[model samples]
Target chain A: MTEALASAATEDILREAAAWRDAGRGVALATVVTTWGSSPRPVGSQLAVDQGGRMIGSVSGGCIEGAVVKEAQDVIADGRPRLLDFGVTNEQAWEVGLACGGKVQVYVERVE
Target chain B: MKRDLLDSLMQAQRRGTTCAMLRDLKTGGQGLYINGEFTGDFASGPNLKPLVLKAISEDVSGRLPEPYQDIFVQVFNPPVRLIVVGAVHIAQALAPMAAMAGYGVTVIDPRRAFATDQRFPGVTLLNEWPDDGLEALKPDRRTAVVTLTHDPKLDDAALSVALKSQCFYIGCLGSRKTHQARLNRLTRMGFGEADLARIHGPVGLPIGALTPAEIAVSTLAQITQVRRAKPAAPQSAAA
Candidate 1:
């Protein structure tokens, strides 16, 4: 049902993250640690990525997800968490389509 | 984060518990905050005390101040609940309004005709004695209890349960003279002035509300004021 899927999407991102980890795959969680004005996603919005490039949830809605996913892959590989800054002063903000012009700081950490 | 820690957080979420997660970026130290119970790799830091309390109180997620600037606190809270212990006219208006304000509203009345789904559509209806219904509900600190039935038997039974629990707000519909009489009865029933003081006598702000909707607005505004003015987390929790 649509309700079940929607609830899973909104309420179970961490559940999916744990599921992937339990299945013997490396998992990474990308969280919007902080935001400065007009950002699409509020602080604590999260994206979960597995080793095979599969990702669930959205940190920046649509914008900056690809970049976060790339960083998540590196976090999974190195087991070293990363803090990514986007928008305003970051040149990659334009390339990544963080079109809102709001600054967002994302913290990506591997689930070990 | 440890798999066990993630499991703990997931378990709390499943139980509709309010909690928080803290992570130190520099040290990779992680902690979980639950009803002042701290657990995890970084639980022992005294400086994390006030930050965790403030973070959960405001339902905010952000970094700590300098010295522990890299520490991020993420809060998770369940929906607020409002238990209306009557299906009267005020409840009819209040239920929908409180739901719009993001409280999961429930209406309780033993009279089946009054507590009908037709009268209170989309609200959880409980056609049971007030005491039994409230006992089953187990109102937590995020819950608000309001008794609107003028009958002593119904209001007192609900008040007994509401007084014993940690509900953030308690309001009863009555005039000042009626509330004084009610307080006398409750006093004889073993409640002290300290416990009775929690009840908002002649409930709702003194806006001279003439209509049910206006009274509901005043009552909801009073509840909001009470909740905002008090510390969301328990006081004596710093230890």
Candidate 2:
């Protein structure tokens, strides 16, 4: 069931990214390429962001989505992909509402 | 090129066709595979082809192999369908729950009053006969057919059609005695014991369910159990 929801969400992100690019709005996609310990979302999860900060989907279930969206803006602007690592400390985990410590690797790329 | 791939993918999804999209992160290349046939051109070399096929067969989405670490495979299958061949109380309870579980539900009954929009809102209501309705719906492997009407006229017709199809689940609501009678009737109609074995008579898991909603839960639970069970070896006709 989780896989089904994640698959559907990824499809939605791809479709929205395509739509945004077609409308001449620069688009970038952030994908969770790897995760260690108790991550909310699994690998292959995606979040799509447009130039104006409009977003669809989630890579870390709101824990690091804000940061990913921020980096996605840069990727869209420069058309250069970058990998981001988020290793949350216990205090940071509490602040971000994650249940425990974990690390997530997200790859952000301009959707061409 | 991306637009064309997106268009084809959207069309395949709308048509409920099984497909997979493979995207290479390193090169930004994309390939679309629909029903085992490749459509768009992408660098899915021989090394990664089997993995893609395995992903499609399992209906799962994940990253590719070590050499193709950057590539991701996303699989899309048709939505599961549930066809309830009666507008009984159990149908009323089951339809909504099935819908909540992401099934496209259709409630069929020739009796107009029982099968009403007021009773089953947001469900596809069919006012035709059981055989005709099942014929039109064309229950596939992703479909589950349940007969709640105890009447031989209705349940038998629906069972005849459902048993012939590749539907993953076929459950008929009845007591043990009633099911025995049903088995005898079907046997008289030329159905063998193997085909009869597929019908989950006295349907639903034995959870001491006494209410309509509880029975619906049990039925859905049993259906989910069968769906998630590992596939067994194919039975030969002579077996």
What TM-score, over all chains together, does every model reach?
0.61, 0.72
Q: Each model's C-alpha lDDT?
A: 0.84, 0.81
List residue ranges in candidate 1 displaced over 4 A: A1-11, B82-125, B129-239
Question: Residue A22 in model 1: shift from native, Å?
Answer: 2.0
Q: How accurate is candidate 2 locally (lDDT)?
A: 0.81
CA lDDT, candidate 2, residue B22? 72
lDDT (Cα, tens digit) per residue for candidate 1, span A15-84: 9999899899999999888778678877787899998889888888688988888889999999888988
Docking class of 2: incorrect
Which predicted model would earn the best DockQ? 2
Q: Which stretches of candidate 2 lie above 4 Å from their native place? A: A1-112, B1-4, B35-54, B64-70, B208-211, B229-239
| DockQ, all models | 0.19, 0.22
lDDT of 2 at A83: 77
Candidate 2 positional error at A43, Å: 6.8
Clashes of each: 0, 0
| Candidate 1 lDDT tens digits, B1-239 | 77777888888877877778888777777889887788996667665778777777666778877777788888777667899999999999999998776577889999998999899998999999999999999998878999999999999999999999999899999999999999999999999999999999899999989899999999999998986554576668666
